[model samples]
Target: MHRHFQGLALLAVAAALAILAPVFCAERPAAAGAAPSPDSQSAAPVVIQVDAAHPTGPYSPAWNYFGADEPNYVYSKNGEKLLRELAALSPAPVHVRLHNLLTTGDGAASLKWGSTNAYREDADGNPVYDWTITDRIFDAMLDAGVQPLVEVGFMPEALSTHPEPYRHDFPKGDIFTGWSYPPKDYAKWAALVTAWATHLRDRYGVESLNGWLWEVWNEPDINYWHGTPEEYDRLYDVTAQAIRSVLPNALIGGPDSTGPGTGRAAEFLEQFLEHCLRGKNSATGGTGAPLNFISFHPKGSPTEVDGHVRMGIQRQLAAMDRGMKIVASFPEYKHTPIILGESDPEGCGACSVATNPSDVYRNGPLYGVSVAEAEARTYELARKNGVVLKGSVTWALEFEDQPYFAGFRDLATNGVDKPVLNVFRMLGMLTGEWLPTTSSGGLPLDDILNSGVTRAPDVNAIATRSEHEVDVFVWNYHDDDVQVPPANVHLNVDGLRQGRVRVEQFRMDSDHSNSYRAWLDMGSPAAPTPEQQAQLERAGKLETLGTPQNLKIAGGRLPLTFDLPRQGVELVRISWR
Candidate 1:
């Protein structure tokens, strides 16, 4: 979830810097590590080789997680629809995270803000607890077949150290208000958290919460917490104790700091790990704290250059590289699960293309292809660093009462789906063990780490094989958002059962599975007719390129050829008789 913060200069040492969140500006300036535009030229046909007999490891759905900033949108008409879609996309469990769950408000949601009025105090320094709004949000999630990554967050009004200006008008004024401060009374804060957890247990049963994840606060290394590092540690210790006291088996961990590429954020993460490992716990006077998982956020730094958007894939990857290395440095917690709490192309999902033109990629196939490439590379990074990646939360969801295709960084606009969500639908189809795959035209991981895919397009594929089926996901991605010639792709599969095979292909591009373009072809209507809405709904679904074909496998090998457009994503599924 995006939260506006006060701007501070971040120094980049050795190609590592903190990618700042969105600011209110006409055009965002290019950062130091932003990828330069690549030459527009056609290249060779890529060859992707997949061996179904050899399995590298088990395939984990690390990209199945998603989140947003507005918590009150959980039950909105559009929000509920989108949640059901997300839950249906994956056979595995889908988890949703949100911000402002504990903020003080009257159950309203807006840009970069949400509230449940979960806690407040009455006269004579007494405690008053309310769980009506919170229960509503959780119930909506459970009803939709999704789990909540409960983000214990932003201070309640009565408990804040500076409660005069609890809520601030975002995008027009200072967002780091009193809600960003620490609690004035630690005991009251602990009791509030304990009561909240107890109520949830009593209402939903203990088994339900054992499967969910609980974390304390967001990005405290920045303005998300106005307190010092020690104070944040104290808050986490107390909060973890409160939750554990109620549900001892709940999966809980925290200090979800910003990207550790910057020196300050990296230092904060290291300090927190030290505190959890050896420092005294303020809650129980124990020697160490309970930490089941570690979390951080890594965002790109896209900017408009030469009247087009250029992605900062290297910037985001650099942050992940630094963070994973940090987690691996400690032998005591080297194998703990690590989650990229808010992974995205850039920060500030609430910022639209109208003001910041760099975000124009959100409404097109670029967003989908970019996510595909980023996730594939992240899995590679985790393997390189020898860490178990829990998941990378895509911080985009549906926004209500918005114009169609307004270019907000979201999976859907109003009620219709965007091209990016189709990528997840494709990812959901992948199951079983990962097959050994290699691409001739793919860029080396080190090369992309040093410089992004600026010299050539990354034409790669991730393939998996089940008992009777094989799935291959391919993408043609470039950092610059400009039209170029399509790449010819040759997909080869080996070790398949020798018999008749049914081959099917699904695609997401400009002409297929894109609702934004469909809306534009309908003359960009403010309020579309019923016919147009139905047409767009059909266009939004994942569509196959052509009818499924039955082909004969000769000597257990099959070769297929196709042309993949720039910024296009495709999935191929083959089943043998």
Candidate 2:
């Protein structure tokens, strides 16, 4: 086995051990509230019906849901180490995206190449292409069992109409330099993609390359693309044709604009879709476009209000709903897979500077809970819209060699798993099949909407079951703030045959695989002592809450009750013989 695979296996073992350790063995305060007695009248089970009849997808595992963006900083030694470390956690497949690969030039004028920064100009102004940097990045992901949600973006410098002032004017101390601008030439852009696609087919084989989803530019409606919608359409046409020229079976598609149903994004998506269906390609003069998938970017807000973090979950969901509706309007796009590319709590992946206000949430549980909540909601929206939502690419991953707590939006800090990653680990265990379930007395849908439940709504539950196993994931989270009132939950599971079902539970809260508080205990990672390091080692653990219990089934119902803290997530798996 490859060394990375071996390393990943070891990390998995460690995580499993941490999750299976005796709950009482860990040093911690007794849970503030007691587990409700089964016979207690007030603790009566809130019976939720499980519809075993209505099922979707063969309960087989859906894609492993995760998010990633290009980490230009990973070019440094420390950044590479951090990426490898994060790769070990949840070795399940991840969706990796290239945010600024099409950027070129320098200072206030550099441009990125999106998926691969392949085109560079020599001193003689000739186009020079390099794949070594991206090859290493993709290799690392492949070794980790990750899949690339290939984002074909920013016009390569040699292809951009405006190429000289290529890069963004990033503030001082910003590590993301030279990777965020439009390409320099269009023909060169097509050639670069064609070459890159052929290279992937050569290096990883055509079969492997076929599985990757090719997305066009990122947030063309926003700062990512300065071109007008018509120009972007032309760019898309040429790029799609180019990609197909090499890999005819390549899954190519994207408008990748920001929030396709609102503001400028909605306008951009509508125009792109219309053009794909009706607008004649100047080159081909045909209505049929190579649109295999539809993609758009949706981001939540990360504003600090009233001394607590506020996430814009509603805004994102609304965007998703609109995007889906727009796609469904066209018969041609009805079956095309929709991707929520670059879905996150906020925009600005490289906003680590002090001037960028959104960087505040990057280092704590705020980011973790926000990511979990946002993803879960995205899934819900997709089901509601009845659209085939394929991937919600998290615009975050490890930045290779930044400081221990450099404030970059990442899944880990200095090789430690963040709370956000714990959610993915929990998700990885739930791949096989989705079962039917019902919840008694959840916050009404309208109540959730009217009250802006994105802040602090109500208890939410989702369940999935297989032949012998049933998994129930429950959460007690509110939208706007972290300080939530304690709530008691009575989970009543029906439809289980009378038998002992072994139960395993995993949880995320103020503790357990949480690096935010660990950083705090370590004095903010600014100054670290030996003891602090030890504390960090202990703190970055996913603690087992309790031992797996073999519960007796009675009267075709099983009852379990526990007090869930605010912003907490719980996973329960019950398997019967």
TM-score of each: 0.93, 0.82
In angstroms, the error of model 2 at 227 is: 1.7
Misplaced by over 4 Å in model 2 are 1-69, 73-92, 105-117, 121-126, 172-185, 356-362, 400-407, 446-451, 454-456, 527-538
Candidate 2 lDDT, tens digit per residue, 1-577? Answer: 0000010111232221122110001111222244223233123233344433334554322224344444354444444554454455444545566555544422121111124556777788777877776676677667656566676755555566555554434333322322334455566667787888888889999888867878777667765566678877887888888888888898888887787646667888888999988897844668757788888876655455544455666666666778888888788777888877667666655555334433545565556655655666666666666677777777666654355655566766656666766766665556445555554424444343343354223455666666778777666555654444445667777777887889888877766667666676545666567877667756665655779898898877777877666566777778877
Q: Considering every candidate listed, which one attains the maximal lDDT?
A: 1
Report the C-alpha lDDT of model 1 over 1-577, residue by residue, as the tens digit: 4443212122222111001000001111222453433333344578888888787778888998899989888799888999999999979999999999999999888888899999987888898888999998999999999999999988999999888777777677778888899999999999999999999999999988888999999999998899999999999999999999999988887778988889998999999999999999999998879999999998887755555667888888989999999999999887899989988888888876445544556888988998998898888889889888998999999788877876688998877889999999999989888988887767777777787777677888898887888999999988877767787889999988788999999999877898878877777798989888888888889999889999999988989999888889999999974
Candidate 1 lands at a TM-score of 0.93
Clashes of each: 0, 48
Each prediction's Cα RMSD?
Answer: 6.6, 9.2
Return the TM-score for candidate 2, rounded to 2 decimals. Answer: 0.82
Query: Which candidate ranks first by TM-score, i.e. highest?
Result: 1
CA lDDT scores, all candidates in order = 0.84, 0.60
